[model samples]
Target: MNITYNQFLISDDKSLLQLDAICGFLGRSYWADRWSRETIAKSIENSLCYGIYDGGKQIGFARVVTDYATMYWLCDVYVDETYRGTGIGKKLIESITSSDELGGLSGILGTKDAHGLYEQYGFVRIPDRFMRKFPG
Candidate 1:
């Protein structure tokens, strides 16, 4: 699906995704700063990816890791530094949370600084109920 907002667009078309731009977003993020380009590429290949565009240039991105019926992990969400505060981030989250394919499944994400943003979409701080384990 493609959603238009003003002159920008949010699309679930993986074919429209630009690898170089996505790498730039993830590479600069504190959370995913350690992620290699290959890792980012492989992750996008296996997950449901979304790209936000200004005309043909990719300006934002997000991807959902999911089991379709059980739950989804929203990760690697980023809007270019140049596009911040334009309601693009909020629109991106809205698009994801309201998507027909992911609407009914529980969603979780890890954000050191975006708590306020996600909370507007019903995500609460559940540090007590969340846990993680490193893969071997």
Candidate 2:
């Protein structure tokens, strides 16, 4: 399977639409509702967003919030349900981690279920320094 991993710019409407589709497949309707089209447009424009396309259609999405020097928080990683288990996710993570923009930083993410996948890429659980803050 030849998948094209492309850098997504803010002006990419097709990529954004693909992202929306991927999110829906992942059961992330909350994201679909919470983020307006303008918000997604802005995110693509300013953030590090990547899309994996099969032929010409998007099948995976990943975003990175990075300082471009120190740390990168890998977030919103989702592969279309139909495309899961075929190494698209691995390729997406590899593509992002190998980029000069993120290669040297500490990559971090918290996954509810895909810890094993992340761990294979050298992401270990931080047993001692974990903390979170939620809406009160």
Task: Give me the candidate number with maximum lDDT.
Answer: 1
Q: Write the per-residue lDDT of candidate 2 for residues 28-100, one digit (tens) a residue.
A: 5333446656666676667677767666567667777877889999877877777777777887777677676
Worst ten in a row by lDDT for model 1: 127-136
State the lDDT of candidate 1 residue by residue for 19-44, as single tens digits.
99999998899988888889999999
**Candidate 2 Cα errors over 4 Å, as ranges:** 1-19, 22-41
Question: What TM-score does prediction 1 earn?
Answer: 0.96
How big is the RMSD of model 1? 0.9
> In model 2, what is the error at residue 112, expressed in angstroms?
1.0
What C-alpha RMSD separates each model from the true structure? 0.9, 4.9
* Model 2 quality (TM-score): 0.74
User: How do all models score by TM-score?
Assistant: 0.96, 0.74
lDDT of 2 at 58: 72
For model 1, name the residue pairs that clash.
none
- Candidate 2: residue pairs that collide: 10-44, 10-45
